[model samples]
Target: MMNRLFGKPKPETNALQTLDKLNETLEMLEKKEKVLLKKAGQEVEKAKEYTRSKNKRAAIQCLKRKRLYEQQVEQLGNFQLRIHDQMIMLEGAKATTETVDALRSGASAMKAMQKATNIDDVDKTMDEINEQTENMKQIQEALSTPIGAAAEFDEDELEAELEELEGAELEEQLLQPTTVLPSVPAGRQQARPIPKRTAEEEELAALQAEMAL
Candidate 1:
């Protein structure tokens, strides 16, 4: 009822529009101030010319007009200062309002999300995820196992076979001929006294020489 009587509280004023209006007013005031200053300067010049003509009354009148123009210029400057002050205040208020609205929106969204999500639902989801992970782990374990890996083998027989193979390798190495070293080329050989060898050493050297052949 009170709102109806008051014709509904006027919608909040648009800060941007108000700021633009202030700016226009400030510009107009500045132009007026400039014009007034020019007129004041002209008046001063006229007063000077009147004084040069020896017309004291005319010079005093011109000086009075110059003072009036100067007063108007000062008033315009004050108007511009007021407009500037209002613009600064309005811009600050706009920024503060926007910041508050943003924070409110964020808080509301968070509250709605919290309302939509239930504790029981979260727990159920976590349980399903754990079950899936366990199932996947079992599947991976099954895939990693080799085919027929479960089959048992005779450990004793396997050890005996490995021993036999080792014995055969040793016998073969013992029967293999020793590698022979190459003799010095005749052209490169230096004349030196040959070292005497023992019977076993001479036999070994003879075997190596035959192997080289």
Candidate 2:
């Protein structure tokens, strides 16, 4: 009972070995059957010869021996059939055992892998990946954001700023001179202002004017 409990079952190998042994036995049985058949034929031939020689008692004895040999041959033939049946069954069992062993190995490997990676570990790994992805997304968003993205500008302040720029541009335009002078004709020339003289020259000019009068 202890041996049975601790014994390793190699069903495939055992089945193959059993089949080989059965086949060897079958071969022996076939040889024996062939020999038996030959003996039976010889006895039949001897019986016929005795009958032809008119030895009736001798022919009957040979016929009886021939029947016994025939029975043994028939028995050997049945044994061969039984051996063939056992070999076929052992081969089928060997194939079945191998298939079962392969399935068992596959199931064991899958169970080992399942033990190595639990559902909780998978969930944790996925959660970490998602966290990293979200962090990277936030970083990208921060990089893509323009400067002062968070600062809000009032509409009134923006309008005032635009108006100031517009007013400054208008004042600069007003400070520039605007002239619209007409063009003079070439036939008419304007006289220049006369120079002021000294008092003696003015008196001399007056005396000359009196003398002329």
Winning candidate number (TM-score): 2
lDDT of each: 0.87, 0.87
What is the C-alpha lDDT profile of model 2 across 1-213, one tens digit per residue?
A: 865897875666677678888888988988888888888888888889999999989989988888888888888888888888888877787788789889999999999999899999999999999999999999999897666844566769889999999999999999999998987789987778898989999999999999999
Q: Candidate 1, residues 65-118: lDDT per residue as tens digits?
A: 999998998888888888888888888888898898889999999999987897
Model 2 lDDT, full chain set: 0.87
Per-candidate count of clashing residue pairs (backbone under 3 Å): 0, 0
TM-scores for the candidates? 0.55, 0.62
* Error at 146, model 1, angstroms: 20
Models, CA RMSD each: 13.3, 21.5
Q: Which ten residues in a row have the lowest lDDT in candidate 1?
A: 6-15
